[model samples]
Target: MYSVVILANGLFPSTEKPLELLSQADKVVCCDGAAAKLLMWGREPDLIVGDMDSLSDSLKKRYSNIIKKCDGQEDNDLSKAFRSCLDYHPSSIHILGATGIREDHTLANVSLLAEYTELLKDIDCTVDIMTDSGVFYSGFESMQSYECKEGAEVSIFAFDNTLKMTCEGLKYQTDHVIFDSLWKASLNMAKSSKFVLKLNHPAKVIVFICND
Candidate 1:
């Protein structure tokens, strides 16, 4: 499927979920310092993208041929690595190590998922943030359903100022409601094997589903 996994320099994935993501990845791209952890794990990334400030000198030299220096302060290392993935025209992109450690960094990184999704909408590429605890999906206007284990924790966040949403198969169901805040939907439980979310109009939203 030409699935690519982008590794960020946040918290390293400690569970099987992240490892499963790596196993399904056709290519793994590390973001700057994240390559260090990948190296420690004895996994070599197909490409490395970032400012190179956090990358050690030895590692940089060793992977010089695959390193793509994007020394721009406007975009973080993760964003740079993500943009680089577009060149490959991947069918899907799974992001790992994008959360954990610094709370502010983690939030910012997660928020970027929407921006990346917007950029790839025309190409019909899917992007999801896979953390140690769960997976985060970004979607804009339309109905989406995800399969989850019964009783799994599911949270939805509005990335935009306003979103009209409806949900089913969750402990808390919303019926054609409008949300203006980012925390409008949070801490809901799955009631069945799957849950569905329907949105009206084009707007960014994040769906976080806990690992079984």
Candidate 2:
């Protein structure tokens, strides 16, 4: 089962999808201000992690037992919440509300997914960011494949300084190419039911399947 983490950003998908995810989550963690959103939706988080700057005083008093404060200013609330989830040793993690509102924050949050993936590599824990537009998966130093309908839109980018990759089953196939810029692999489409990517080093890959 997956552990769900909700960030403070206000870019969650429709209510139905998040509720569905909550229902299936083995544990739910809220990052600081996100607790207020969960409370508004009539759900109590299993744990709340952050610097306590965004959490209201009343809510803090009310949910004191579940609140775990991480006052490190170096990392954002999302990173704090992620560290807290390590205690539960979840099989995988699904992130919500990580985008939207502030474009700078959105990019920063999305960029951190690769670093988080590298941190969890030894434990074999997968991390994904879920948004209304699509889902982003983080992969490192391995071969990975995804199942998607033919003609689906897919994008892959390098998170590190450089990414060495080879792929098949995409509209524009790549054979052992090194990508240095994020835009190098954008706007690709799936050519078959499945697509495969072989990575020579740690990297971040994002696939966007048409919601329709």
Candidate 3:
């Protein structure tokens, strides 16, 4: 399968898992300032995408051939890089450097995972946001199972507070809980090697599983 990795302008990953994935990606796409980070790490980006506002003139001139300038106010640089990845028709897309440093940007990028899931569902492409702490996945309201290490941290978030859900293999049961607040069902732990989530209706939800 064609796998693509997108590096954003957030904190550059220094952890082992994110770094390994970045180094192993078939194609590494950078978003404006992230191009400089990739180069400093001794790896060249296959494609640099953004509005060109964050990049320096010398770096732009040096990598002009590989840069894709997307000047639009509607989407951020990370979004532009993701849209560009669609042209490659990759089977899977992994996003890194999308969290930390700025709290606002981190939250926005995390929420975009849900939007990306909606956009790529029909195309059968998997998208994930990998952070220094964990990995983020967006899915619809359904019975979803995730294989993870025992005692791993798990958190679920949804835009609709009325949405009810249940889970198996979690330290705390979620059947009787109302998701009125974003932190209502956070900081959960897995009791087994895998956990299952059963949603009450068809709605989008974001799940985060920390690295083992």
Best by TM-score: 3
Q: Please give, for residues 1-212, the per-residue lDDT of candidate 1 as tens digits.
A: 79999999988888998988887788999999999998888788999999999999999999999999987689899999998988888999999999998999989988899899888879968999999889998877588778889999998988554566788899987664456665678889999998888877677788899887
Please give each candidate's TM-score.
0.92, 0.88, 0.96
TM-score of 3: 0.96
Off by over 4 Å in 1: 176-180
lDDT of each: 0.87, 0.77, 0.91
Best by lDDT: 3
| Ranking of models by TM-score | 3, 1, 2
Kindly give the stretch of ten consecutive residues in candidate 3 with the minimal lDDT sum: 139-148
Candidate order, lDDT descending: 3, 1, 2
What are the RMSD figures for all models against the true structure?
Answer: 1.8, 2.3, 1.1
Q: List the residue pairs that clash in candidate 1.
A: none
lDDT string, candidate 2, 1-212, tens digits = 65655555456556565557666778889888888887787777899988888889999999899999998779998988888898988888888888888888888887888788878978967787877767777666578788877888888877444566788899886655457666777888988888998877645665545443
Residue pair clashes in candidate 3: none
Question: What are the runs in model 2 whose C-alpha is more than 4 Å off?
Answer: 15-18, 160-162, 175-178, 200-210
